[model samples]
Target: MERPIGVIDSGVGGLTVLHELKRQLPKEQFIYLGDTLRCPYGSKGEEEVIQYTWEMVNYLMKFDIKMLVIACNTATALVLEQLKQNLPIPVIGVIEPGARAAIKATQSNHVAIIGTENTIHSQAYEHALIRIKPNIDTTAVACPKFVPLIESGNFVLEEAKEIVEESLEFINHYPTIDTLILGCTHYPIIQSLIEEVVGPRVTVLSSAVETGFEVSTLLTFYNLYHANTEEIHEPAIFTTGKLHVFQRLKEDIFQLKNASLKHITLS
Candidate 1:
């Protein structure tokens, strides 16, 4: 199919998932929308998040997309089921895949999830993990500052390491939690920093990679997998904030070549 797959997030965090999607399914096209204008949806009210999430969905539906991936944990937690029930196309989220991966990787049954304030509050990962393995013990931490650091592209700085360490100090007491789920899409940008803070005992998991694999499985199940691998199409990137911000990250960090990025406004 020529139609692209739509991926949406509160900001550039979604690029982590899109990056993996590109590697896993190179033949398919992608339309990534980052709601950078009203980002850090971490602290927003549930009603506001749902409204913003729908705005992104409405915006992406403008394209001829075959599927929709809610790459933001906050959005997925708040509105994924609603989107799936209402949208015509298939809809997927990052929570389940990450929960699944953690369930398989953890030996101690105690799992740690670090995400935005809203995502942690929603207990989406906890629900998903417990649903799959009822006895799973989940400890969720709200890392409110992580998203802004990543959104500003300051993830590689020394201060970023300090922020990661400070935010993750709570995990130190819970040493039994051997598996950490990077619940926010943006968290993957600072994966190495997180790994350093958590040390070798805990295996950190990002939903980005697992989410990409989930997309692949859905594409095949829906019979939407592209037939022509030779004809590759550059993913379209859009931001409801600054085009330059998205452009720089797409170019320097994401290293996504030939991407056409534009500034857009959503009502």
Candidate 2:
């Protein structure tokens, strides 16, 4: 009764979610797949995004995962409901949890969201927020350069800081916004930089963290909690692109000890 949780993302961005999952539910095993070959589903069309997300779901299903977490925002925005309807296992996405967190964090009734072009365009987070609280004001900005910078391993460089500052300039004029949602999973990789740019006043939210909480709640709701409190395997990692970068981040950035990663191809 210790089937693993399946977490999928377009790339290493989902590691942020995995980090939280591990912190919150240490006893549970996880199988994380990053479709890095097709990284940045943020730029793709709705159909292509949905197709790629399904390919991920199909790939992860082979592991007999007890739960599924769509850790990628673009995929969640485009394909989550469909996956929930069709997949036998319980499925959850990062958006609703993120929106709820934003609702809880914002005291000014104003929230700002930063994500990829497609995510902001979809207005998924805005709609989710509005559905619960009709009077909230939301402003969404697309930071098109972030995902690639993060995927390329340049997110920590000074150029990335410049880009973040430039891309977020719009929020400076948005005086009322007291909360900012990192709508794209990739954004949390540079959460400090975002907080620096946004200054100390506006609270930055990581959807990954909130998603982890939601996953824990559902694990209990569905009675899918891993019974082993002692643990089993070093969480398995798979990627459809080059392994070196993912490996470096997992070891150095995340300090995931003895974790094994493999190269994978998704049809």
Candidate 3:
């Protein structure tokens, strides 16, 4: 029960989820692995995404994690079921939590989703939404350029604003959509820009909060909550690529000054 939870993503994007989890369950420890070197899994083939995701999971399993959180939308879409069935610990994904959040936020039962190419093409959010609310109206857009822009650490520039605007132009056509789901975990890093582009009429929701809540609920159900309240927990973060941006985000964005970060390679 004291074992750390494992969170994995294609890149630093998963930190958004990790941040929420830490806030919600302050006593629990977390180990994060971001496959930054071969990131942008949104455009990769299904087989490749599955393989890469499994590699990340296999690596995390070494730490004797109590649970696994698939923080990448593409990997969640492609491999969540397999991980859930095969792994001893519970597994949760961002898509269903995100879909539920969008459904709850929408006034018209119409929602829009924007994510990586593979996630959009997989229709995972749309299906999750419709399955929960059978009559929900959903529109999905594939923003293949987002991950690269974010990974470059240039998402704060004016060019990022233009890219976000251009990528979301289609949202204007859907007047009925009162809720927009940030389908990819990385999207929340640029949530303000996305909200500006789509305007105030639509509410932008990130699955991180809901995902964190779900994690807390599961931990309690299984009695996996960390028993020691006085322990200071510093998350362990790992990435397979450059560390500059990851380090900056950890300190500046996530405010995890004491979190341990290291570069890692997977074969």
**How well is each residue in 38-116 modelled by candidate 3, as lDDT tens digits?**
9989998999999999999999999999999999999999999999999999999999999888878989988999999
Clashes of each: 0, 0, 0
Clashing pairs in 1: none
When sorted by TM-score, best at the front, the candidate numbers are 3, 2, 1
Please, what is the whole-model Cα lDDT of each candidate in the order they appear? 0.91, 0.91, 0.93
Candidate 1 lDDT, 65-163, residue by residue in tens: 889999999999999999999999999999999999999899999999999999999999999999999999989989999999988876788999899
In candidate 2, which residue ranges exceed 4 Å CA deviation?
none
lDDT of 3: 0.93
TM-score of each: 0.97, 0.98, 0.99
Kindly list the per-residue Cα lDDT of model 2 for residues 1-267, writing each as its tens digit: 599999999999999899888888888898999999998889888899988999989999999998999999998888988998999999999999999999999999999999987899899999999998999999999998999999999777899999999999999898999999999988898999999999988999998778888999998898888887776567899999999889888988776767789998888
Worst 10 residues of 3 by lDDT: 100-109
Which of the two candidates, 2 or 3, achieves a greater TM-score against the reference? Answer: 3
Flag clash pairs in model 3.
none
Q: The CA-based lDDT of model 1 is what?
A: 0.91
Better of 1 and 2 by TM-score: 2
